[model samples]
Target: MDKNELDKRIADLQAERERLTGELDKARTEARDAMIAGQKPGGTAAALAERLSIVDDALAELQDRTRSAADSAERNNRKRRAESALEATSKRSKLAAAVDEALNALASSWDAYADALRKDVGQVSGAGGDLTAVERALTNNRAAEPLVKALIQSGGVKLARTFGIDTPIRERHAISLADAENRVAESLRVELLRVKAESPQPNVSREAQAELEKMETAR
Candidate 1:
């Protein structure tokens, strides 16, 4: 059957399963109460026992159906994922090749980059224009970081903005470690809200759509 039909069937079975489970519990309680009252077999006690058996059988059947439906849904999802991955393989390979070429080109200009760094920072007496020393100086100069990044971006045109094969570098607002920690804390709150929305709750304290008005008021 189609996805919508399968989903509806699963949901109906789940609700019935829950109902059967509750009925079974009630039957057991009734049987216990009858026995405590010194009731004999083949009457109220026997009726309750029989009802419990029927409920258990129905619950088991529903459980099997639920599992089969869930497995079918999972298989459909897996097939879709496999198809998407196969489609993207060619793009991924091209991006990988571009990245390798960029690295090789950058490697050839290492000495020239070090010389430029020395010129920008001004040479020290003992450094003696040594390539390693110049490279170290460039690495240690925090001011040169932005310039180096710009150079890499310029040389790697395939990796630039709007290249859909992979994510391109972009400027982002700098935040402190404390700000990052606070963002993670907020993410936890968002996750809690998502879980509450998705979980099936027979009873709820408040309607989520109504509570959403609080967010608007805060804004």
Candidate 2:
């Protein structure tokens, strides 16, 4: 049965229990009066005992019904909670996955743009700040333009003419774009897990609360 129905039934049963208790008390009073007035009292005593038994049995049955209704309510609540958790998980998973796809696309596009930019500027500083700005532009809109316009705006794209086309810059190997992309990957992984873990519903098991302990020191 539903919670409201169960609650009404419990309230009705409680009222019945109260009525039974009152009847039991009245019966005891009647039996005592019979004994005080010099009547045999045997009949009243016998009836009182029986009424007591009836009240006890009725109370036991009501207690059982109360417990059963409580158990049912708990089961229903659990079913709803599980369904909600599943729905939340699905939504969060999709959001995190979308984030992953978007970042990956940005990285790929940025890598291509960086390659072109590098060639045009003859392997300019492989600074993460430059690529980061480009990556942001890929996601947003870039204020920087190309050739004449860009050159006029940002001074100009200057190259180290001392380095030959075949030679490396300052005798140091060019850093792969993958290195910066790795940093992005690490950042994404943490954010993805955070997205998955952040929930209004309790993720911790009820039983686990007992076993949890405060750490004395870092491992």
Candidate 3:
């Protein structure tokens, strides 16, 4: 049962008691009117007393029923309150469990992201030695000059355009590659740390704790 249902029951009982009281008052009034009417002929005091006694007894019975209804209403109200409290506690416990799962998932995702960043940085760094060797090979061969110049011109133009650099061809290529590599490394490090920092910590809401206590009491 819920509070609203209990309140409705109490209201119905009160209304019924009021109706019974009204009926009892009406009965007493009718008895008095009868005695008054009887006074005209054979209006014996004994007859009047008997009619009044019956009215009194009926009124007492109605009063007893009214009292019994009030007591039942009070008991229902107490039961409803206890049930409502128990339900609220159960809901809160379920909510807390959901929150705990969400936090654990978030932490797991952050850890995975950090691991991926570390792998990406390692792959990029492994290419650094190979890139340096290519630069050295281009620098030392004069007989291979035309081929090197053609390669530089074609690659430099594309690299410069892609990187948004407007410098001399050789300088632009070198600067763009170094800058891109450094930026990737730095970005990976920063993002990994940010994910670690944003990971959820252990904590619980006060309302959730209170609800848990209520559930324990019910058990």
Candidate 4:
């Protein structure tokens, strides 16, 4: 396909993905509201959840297609001059290896402390600010919160600070894009198990029920 056609298709797919995401979000919100209100969700919640899952699958497929199309178009548009320019740019990137090594060290440090940090931050670690800020700071090897900076500097391989209060070694230490995500998933699984145990017989729809089962099996 021509570049213009490929670009248009990518854009259209992205728009559809966004729309589906919004719908899924709305459905989740409604389901949460119902649970908070102590209302027994009839079939609507279950159906909404099923529809959301289907939309999520479609979105994933569309994103893969969009990326493939964009890549093909870029390759089709590449020329000898562009190749030479890219090669020269890569050769001059002296800081690339240093940056990669630094980030790897930070990720390792974070992994060492993942369990403690998860307990301390709770769900906030997965949300905005804390995890995002810490990860960004680590990636650039820039300064972040005093504790995080110290953690990165230590390479997550040794002690950086001591707490007067009694605490476990893991809590006192630090360690990814992938590493960070894995930690979050680890924390989430723990939280989900706790929630499932505490909130037994939750009056949710079949869709939510299925999702809960999936969460249980995530690890």
Candidate 5:
């Protein structure tokens, strides 16, 4: 049996022993009271003693078995943990390799990238986002998982910089997925309001536009 099962059995045996002990004590008291009063006792003190002894023997044997089971269970648990850690580490390496492969493939497809860049009319600027929480989370495994995942999925060329795998993404954004989503949404709404104000369409009624303005004001 497993350690937990063994422990439960041990607990049950101990409970039974406690119950028997209480009964045995009451039996002895009754027998003593009857002898003092010069009458036959109703108590079965000998039978109770024999039952208690049997329980004691069983409890002792089960406790010894549990000690060995506990050690074996602990060893097996650690073994699984060690094996799982190796697999996790291997997968981590594979993930990094996959990212690198994607980067290399992108570099190979340079003509499309050049065309997109040349056609881009957007202004260039740094994101200047705060990285305080991300930096702090690095030392903590539980906290870092989601943070690192969000950073990778945020879709920047210099994700390596966030984890110190490469240089800093200077003049570039180092934002998590949630923050990136918020920024994209906010930027789009602002542009929508500006366009609606500049050239009011038939569909963009005054009341609808007022709600957008209200949202801006609330923020």
Candidate 6:
């Protein structure tokens, strides 16, 4: 090919390499922002992989064009430009991988925190009931005041402190006291069963020995 034609091809490859480098930079920035914003696990990794694929394609094209260019100063400049683009792409890929790992860790932390909160709140609310039920039960005059106080404090004193309410007791009514006590007992029973089932231990003799012996004989 003519010198002029070779120079034009080299220039085109150089421009394409620069464009790909810019795209890699943009992708790395986006991935970093997503990590800071606490994106879900694997999202950043997928994005980084996509950007790396583009970089690989552009690098291959740059290499082919550089090899076909005529031996001259223009060819040397294009080769240097290709090398710089490859280096930038490599750096951005590493940065993207780091960001993805960080975001995944953050997502795991958030999930663990949420799960713990759910368990804590569930303990206070009891089965088949909401926080309001627990609050009303605590208002009953018949309810054990110490137990009620512990429940309120366990749910975080900040809630009561924020609303300027008493730590142990809120507004109480005499008429609903009996009903509240009954509801509280039922809720506590259900919660106790749930806890027991979650951590059950073997009790070999809880049932009648005759029935156990019969079952053993049958086996």
Model number with the top TM-score: 2
Q: How would you encode candidate 4's per-residue C-alpha lDDT over 71-190 as one tens digit per residue?
A: 876786786669898988787675787767877986787666554555656456544223542344333343334344345445442343432222232534444234555655655655
Deviation from native of the Cα of residue 19 in model 2, angstroms: 5.9
Write the residue-wise lDDT of candidate 2 on 85-192 in tens digits: 999999999999997997698569756775665553322222212334224223334332221122223332232221112222231322334544454454444444
Query: What lDDT does the true structure give each of the candidates?
Result: 0.53, 0.52, 0.53, 0.57, 0.64, 0.55
For model 1, residues 31-114, the per-residue Cα lDDT tens digits are 678778997423544565565566566657656766787898899999999989988997899998998897787566655755
Ranking by TM-score: 2, 5, 3, 1, 6, 4
Candidate 3 contains a number of clashing pairs equal to: 0
Global fold similarity of model 3 (TM-score): 0.30
> Model 5, 134: alpha-carbon shift in Å?
35
How far off is residue 202 in model 4, in Å?
99
Using lDDT as the yardstick, the better of models 4 and 5 is: 5
What TM-score does model 1 achieve against the real structure? 0.30
User: Scored by Cα lDDT, where does model 2 land?
Assistant: 0.52
Candidate 6 accuracy as TM-score: 0.25
Which residue pairs in candidate 6 collide?
A: none
Q: What is the lDDT of candidate 4?
A: 0.57
Candidate 6 lDDT score relative to the true structure: 0.55
Please give, for residues 1-219, the per-residue lDDT of candidate 6 as tens digits. 555665676577567657666766777677788779997444554655576677567657655655665346677899899999999999999999997997698469645644554565555554554344334333335543433443344444554455454554642322233344455565565455545445545342333344444545866
Alpha-carbon deviation at 64 in model 2, angstroms: 2.3
Error of 1 at 15 (Å): 9.8
Winning model by lDDT: 5
